[model samples]
Target chain A: MSTILLIEQILNGLQFGVMLFLMAAGLTLIFGVMGLINLAHGSLYMIGAFAAAAVAGWSGNFLLALIASLIAAAIFGVIVEMTVIRRLYKRDHLDQVLATFALILIFSEATRWTFGSFPLFLDIPAVLKGTVILPGGIEYSLYRLTIILIGLAVALGLYLLISKTRVGMRIRAGENDREMIGALGVDISVLYTMVFALGAALAGLSGALVGAIQSVEVGMGEPVLILAFVVIVIGGIGSIRGALAGAILVGLTDTLGRTLLPVLFSSFMDGSAATTVGSALASMLIYILMAGVLIFKPTGLFGSA
Target chain B: MISKNAKRTVKALGAATALALSLGQVAVADGHAGKLKVGMLTTLTGGGAGLGVDIRDGFLLAIEQSGNAGIEVVVEDDQRKPDIAVQVADKMIQSEKVDILTGIVFSNLALAVAPSATAQGKFYISPNAGPAQLAGRGCHENYFNVAWQNDGPHEAAGATANKMGIKKAFIWAPNYPAGQDALTGFKRTFEGEVAQEVFTKLGQTDYAAEIAQMRASDADGIFFFAPGGMGISFLKQYADSGVDLPLVGPAFSFDQTILPAVGAAAEGVLNTAQWAPDLDNDASRAFVESFKEAYGRIPSIYAQQGFDTGLLIASAATKADVKDADAFRAALREADFTSTRGDFKFGNNQHPIQDFWVRKVIQLDDGTFINTAVEVALEDRQDVYATECALDW
Candidate 1:
């Protein structure tokens, strides 16, 4: 394989990884603060994409779509939190899982009913419509590059929000001692709702950004949700830094393995056999990495030990 | 206490929505003289719902246009799950006692349901899926496919590629029976060296790695068969990546329902299909006009197949005694219906021997994408698997 091709593949991996981070960040935050497993987190992602597509179609403005996605997801998140999730907080994990799973079905059906079965179109903005020549003379999509930058900025912003702000302090306090924080002057219920909405807005932003490059349709969030779960699990369930690390790790492994495995196998075997084996192994590469990581560090790369 | 009351209200609302959604599926009976019961099972609420919705809509439109008071349709959502499809099929056969079974869109779901349905002496007139196995040794006398065989469009693509003189081509498909069949079909007719054959995970959204590999390959042309959202994602990403190669594929990817979502990414892409909205035939024109009037959008190939299924059934019902299985089956074999596609006939295997056209995606004046037939690629093509069938006439 050419060095340039390898470099391009890595960039693709990085782009994929960063997007996963956007999803993982929210999931990890919700879990960290609320001590609740939100299985319907992916539904929020779908809501965001639909909101973006709807806004983009009406106004033909990418900026408006982005804002709409965030606002819609946040409002929806808060409503879900208030109506259903708050009730599940004192319940057991099994109940939480079942309730959220029901939410998935409801959200999926409702989205289909509202938008119709066909995918909605969400276009790349005019300014970021083409490719750019990187340093190695490799042409890359400017839109994909923007996604990477946006993900990084969001990650940094999340870090600042958690470590440098009063809301962040309260979130940390809640994570460590929910009862104690509630005993203190902080309105823990409102704090929980805000935290959930913030996480949802992040998910919505990711959905809108990715929706431009992919189809905006129902059940788009399920695949990403599974990956985000893997990211958070690998990163150390509650750590933003861990989510980033785990996401990049999973992304690079998946991308590079998929690209290089067939070529490597073909050198030692026949073409068709090599391809069959290589692709099979490549699909499992990330899960294999996760298994390996768990064997070595049960808490994940950055999870609390 | 107030918050608890609010929670109860919310719970009630959720329950009401669920109840209403389920209630929507309950079939309404319209009293008619002749009895022809059809159980329409198709994906209605998942990723593959677009194609299924088209099929259901077209099938219903045909039934409506016929004003066949004898026909009672029982529509159910399969949710694209094979197990669920089997359960629904069983209910239709045993409980509903529908005379005709149709409106299955996926080959996997069809494979799971068709065999059992046909074995029970129920006629399965497929609206969309035409698995090769069913055309070969698995073929039954009672089973009929209104659509082209699964491999038909892909073989047309291969012929088109050969005509275009593509020396080296890279092919990609999702890893499944249909996907494998697509590649095999393409290779059967194409006289060119395959640079690469990539089988991706079904429903894989991201294709960056695969695209990178394709870009680095020395292939002059590319062909892929990714339906629904997968196709939408792949086309968009491939366009964004700026890999300027001649792209060709089966019409599933560039169909009318998905073409708008694919947008300019699908422009100039060649696809092969047995039906296009622009086909110059009376039946085609009427079906298109009526379908548009009913559905407010251009019909896809799946919809065409559904309409054809309805036509086939309606024609057979009119001519033969549908109450007699033998007469109905024989009449269906005569292929007396006026197909939306001009000059349609059935092969010995009961699949359509239809003309496959080379279609190019073009944007209309109203800024919507539709496929226009550029040329006829294959004429009256029968699937290769037809010779394998041992069915006695």
Candidate 2:
């Protein structure tokens, strides 16, 4: 393989990793603050894509669509938090899982009803429509590059929000002790709602950005949601820093493994057999990594004992 | 005394109603003119729902146009699962006692359900999902396919690619039976070395890794079979990746239902199919116009197959009594129906022998992508596996 190709593949991995971070961050935050496993997080991602598609179709403005996605997902998230998710806060993990799983079905069916069975269109803006020539003369999609940048910016912004702000301080306290924070005169319910909405908005942003490249359709979020779950589990659930690290790790492993394994296997065996084995192994690479990590660090890379 | 007497009267009334209902069922089943219960089993949820929805709409449209009052259709969602399809087929066959079964959009599901239905002596008129196994040694007397075999369009694509003299090409497909058949069919006629043949996960959305590999390959052209969202994702990503190779595939990738979602990325791509909306035939034009009016979207090839199946069944019902298995099978074998695809005929294997057209995705003045028939690629094409069928009836 060419050095240029390797560099490009690495970039692809990084791009994929950052997107996972966007998804994992929200999931970890919700899990950390409320101890609620929200399986419907992916549904929020779908909602964001649908919202962006609808808004872009009507307004023909990418900025407006992005704003619409965030607001729509955030409002929906808050409503879900208030109505259903709040009820599951004191319940066992099984009830939380079942309730959120039901949300996924409800959201998917409702989206299908509204958008019809066909996929909705979300175009990359004109400015980001083409490729950019990197220093090594390798061409990369500008839109994808933009996604990486946006993801990194969001990561940084999340760090700032968590470490430097009063709301962030309250969140940290709540994560440490929910009842203690409530006893200390903080409106714990409102804090949980805001945190849920924030996580949802982050998911929405990722969806809107990724939806331009991928087909915006129903059930589009489940695959990414699974990956995000892996990211959190590996990164140590509820750690944004860990989520970022794990996302990038999983992304690079997946992307590079898919590209390189076949080439490596082809050297020893026939081309077709090598490719079959290589691709199969490549898809399993992430899970293997997760397994390896869990074997050593049972709580994840940053999780508490 | 009053309560006991009331209970006895109620018991008598209930028994009488049960007797009447059973008698009514028998009356409806005994060659009743309009009582043909058809089970429409298709994917109506998840990723494959679009194709199923189209098939359902077209099938229903044809049924409505026929004004067949006795054709009571029972629709069920299979969710694109083979197990679910088999269960639904059983329910329809046993509980609902549907005389005719139709509307399965995927080959895997059809393979699971069609054989069992045919074994029970029920007429299995397939609107879509023509697996090669059923067209060959597995062919049964009671089963008839309204659509072409799974590899029909792919074979045409291969022939077209060879005719265009493309020497080296890269091929990709989802990793499944249909995907494997697609590559095999493409290679049958295209006498060129494949740069690479990659099998991706069925519902994989991101293609950056695949596209990057394709970009680096020394291939002159590309052919892929990624239906539904997979196609949309791959085409859009390929367009953005600055790969300028000529791309070709079966029409499933670039059909009307998905073309709008694919947008500008799909333009100039060539695909092969047995039918297109612009095909100049009375049935084709009428079906397209009415489909748009009914569904507000141009019908995909799945819908055309469904419509044709409806027409085929309706014509057969008029000629033969469905209650008589021999007569119904004979009437259906006559192939006396107007098809959206002109010159449709049934081969010995009960699969369609039809012309396949090479269609290029063209953007109209209103900025909608539609497949325009560029040329007839293969005329009166019959599946290669059809000769293996030993069924004489």
TM-score top scorer: 1
Q: Give the TM-score of candidate 2.
A: 0.92
lDDT of each: 0.86, 0.85
TM-score against native, each model: 0.93, 0.92
Residue B360 of candidate 1: its Cα lDDT? Answer: 91
Which residue runs of candidate 2 sit more than 4 Å off their true CA positions? B1-34
Q: Give the DockQ (2 decimals) of all models.
A: 0.35, 0.24
lDDT of 1 by residue, A206-304 (tens): 999999988888778877887887787788777789999999988898889987898899999997778778888888898889889978987788877
What local lDDT does model 2 show for residue B86?
94
lDDT string, candidate 1, B102-180, tens digits: 9988888899999999999899999988888899999999899999789989999999999888999999888766887
- Tens digits of per-residue lDDT for model 2 on A69-114? 9999999999999999999988765667667877887898789778
